[model samples]
Target chain A: MRFRFTGIFDLFNQKNEYYLINKKLDTIIQINESMYKVLSNAKQGTELNCNEINLNTMNILIYNRVLEAIN
Target chain B: MKRDLNKPIVIHWCMNNCNKQGQIPKGVIEGKIRQAEPIKIRFINPRSQEDWRIIESFANESSDIKEIQVEYDFLEYDIKHCIDIDIEKKLIYLVAFSGTSYLDHDARNRLCNMIKKQDNFKIIVYISHKNIAESVCFIQSVYNEVKQGEFIIKPEKNIKNELTDISVLHEAISQIAELYKLFPDIKLSVYDEEKIVRDIIRLPYYMYGNMYITGDGNISMYSFMPAYNYGLSDPQVTLEEAWRKLYHEHATCDLEKILEYPRYWFKYFNRKEIK
Candidate 1:
């Protein structure tokens, strides 16, 4: 279904690699360009269709608890 | 000409290998210099071995420099020699990191005794990312030591990275804000709305009547960002000439336009709820 990015995370690009830094957990996880684009465009509390992103990658992100489903 | 003591004079201590060293022109100190008002000088938290050696050497070169007060960093190096000489003078102990945790109870007691003896002294704790409860307890331990002195908690700046997360920065601001509630008397360097707006029209606080003396003896009107270079301090330039150049050049730039950038604007402006 639809999903949104977490508010506790900060997105940044360093050395051509994109990282999501979770301030609450003090953790950083690197993601690919496609994931970066999707996350960057997804506003907090807004829903994004699963078809908008690669289903396999989206599954991995949700599994890792980086992205949460809104509906 | 005698300088007025009432006016504020801010001095920035720089080491020889400072990043701005290359920017200073050579042989700028050959001319006669003007004398300014006599102000008390203090050195704060000099860390590097090279910096310490240069400071020691600089002090030895001039007896006047040796008399200047200092706030020694207990975490960096042994300040026994500095304490021995300036025992009677105003001393400051800057505790950063988990510096207090490293000291044994007896040593901590001795340190407090030394601080209590000084007529004018301060214990400034630089807040860091360490556990807040542990940090507060460390401060309280030293608090029990001194009878009368200023205890300040300052938020440390994140100077390394140009881009800092807004959330992280706000968290730091909130933490330091809470300290004011605990110790109402503590002073902070952050600007209020009045100060920020005042600076927007005029020069920022750091630029006002300030002089930076680098380790190589070069002088600049502004410490980190000098609009105009005043050359070396050895040959000596008049404080009037330096101020004139700094004020004149700084006035020409549109600070408002400069402040419009997200990073600069964010520093002075805070969002408040409309309700």
Candidate 2:
């Protein structure tokens, strides 16, 4: 299934690490380079495999509605 | 000594409404932003084709800017301008205007058409209470017709009085919260529950990191704070230094009052009257 970021999210790079802030969810998540790449790819319309990302991370993200599944 | 004080995260560029020609040159604006390198750039009431083009250029450019927003105040001349060019950055558009005593069908239609042409344009319809009394029917017509925007019903005089009286401010907040419950889309100017929480976490208070700069080079950290009085008058002080100083001074914030006052109306207010 394809997934996209839901609502408005601000991505900022600080001290060589990336963080994603979602104002609607009142969330600020520190993302590793790999997770950042996955999000960047998804942003560019790349199909993401569910198994490619950690199950816990995916579950948390989906639970927060940060990443919504799209057909 | 806060880390973010090293530089302002956002800088607002406000154009001269009376004489659009009185604006700082585009090259100078570009130079300042490049030097300051704020995370976001906001253009407030950019009227002419030249203004739109500058906005379009900034929107299209690949830079450190995470957001580009426009707060457009409609005058007779503004309805003719539209954002037709392609933009890479997502823009948050807040539109507020005072209405005449009568319904302006032509202006309303023009506004609707302009809104139709863009994506991700969230408008905040802030009508002055006096105008509301005169043009309630006009406002209602636009409200029913324009389904894409957010609405805020506030009084003009309350801009100062509400801030000084905390109880009245609380009542206003309750009223706005009740309004939100009735209509989920309508929100208090700066009181989005999630946004408030997010702001607290990210900064000392909501809008703490944001600063405004006028065409003539005056700067202010808060909307209510007069740019002329609290501006970057001292050439020795850099943008970052001035911001840090202001941050230290206003630590005990007027959070509720700040939320009540709309930032766009900062320009419209007479300097002598605000206090």
Candidate 3:
């Protein structure tokens, strides 16, 4: 199934570090450089195959409503 | 997003002589004057007839100006009778500032007296002093004299910090905590239910439908980001031309930009989870 990040998240770069802010929950979670790239893509509506991305990262994003099924 | 050109919620009109850079265009006023609906104007620290003349000129052009508020900076200028004239005319709602280093004893007394006299004004006391006793005393003195007026304590240390610095957020949270401990009655500006909901929805609260004119005649749509600077624009460029640059170059309130800006209260709220 194809998936994309929800609208509740936004990307920010503070002090050369990438952080994801949940606009709905007003929470911040720092993500690694690679994770940042993936999420940035997701934010731009890039679709991801469930098996392609890191499972743990996908699980966290899905669990937090950061990602939702495209279908 | 396209804003309703007809109605501008507020115009921050800085009437000071100092060349501090106003970001709102003269064209905004000129454009708004042609409309029937009067725009609200907040006069920032108006001190002279020159400022009043500007107000009169706008008033003469159109009846589009419905409300006027004065941000009275008591420290910089004396209590002028021109303000009294407007207040008497029911044309002014006052927002006065008083605090350490900003207001001397005599000035504080003058501010307090004005507050007591006016029924339509709020006094904001910015507390930046290290001594808690001194801070409390400053607040008490104002309250004691006025007897029935509200004063907001803005705990700012007068230090400029890069917006990206997390340490600054920590310092702000600590200061707020200190204030809460001493003055439990002190209210946070964020307690407004509407504003809370707006923040959650990522809607613009302060910057929504408002524009600014800085002291030096620079025009900006958002206070967080300045669109025009005299250094970048030509020295003889008109505010109309400057405003065009702002309109083309910047989004009024980009969500990514707003999220990136340092909202210390958000950090304070999600302190444990921010890392």
Highest DockQ against the true fold, candidate: 2
Best by TM-score: 2
The DockQ assigned to candidate 1 is 0.01
Runs in model 2 with CA error above 4 Å?
A1-9, A13-71, B1-5, B17-26, B47-50, B79-84, B87-91, B99-103, B127-140, B152-208, B226-238, B241-275
Off by over 4 Å in 3: A1-71, B1-7, B20-38, B56-62, B84-89, B93-98, B102-106, B127-135, B155-158, B161-201, B204-208, B229-248, B252-255, B262-275
Best by lDDT: 2
Q: Write the per-residue lDDT of candidate 1 for residues B42-155, one digit (tens) a residue.
A: 454565554454445434443222134455555455566433464434333443344235676766766676567654455555454443345556655565445455555543
What tens-digit string does per-residue lDDT give for candidate 1 at A1-71? Answer: 66777564656554445556442222335556776777887744546767777777677567655678765
Candidate 3 lDDT tens digits, B102-162: 5667876777776777765565544433433454566555555566555544534223323
Rank candidates by lDDT, best first. Answer: 2, 3, 1
Q: Score the docking of each candidate (DockQ).
A: 0.01, 0.12, 0.02
For candidate 2, write residues B1-275 as lDDT tens digits: 12233456667777554554554555555555656767667788776677787877777777777778787776435533466435523676666554453326776676676556655544443434334333344444554566555443434432443322456545545544554464456323433332243335434212355666776666665443455434344444467766666566652243333444544233234354443
Could you tell me how far off, in angstroms, the CA of residue B114 lies in candidate 1 after the best superposition? Answer: 3.4
Sort all candidates by TM-score, best to worst: 2, 3, 1
- Residue lDDT tens for model 3, A1-71: 78887876667554445556543222345556777777788888877756657787577678767898766
Give Cα distance to truth, residue A46, candidate 3, Å: 51
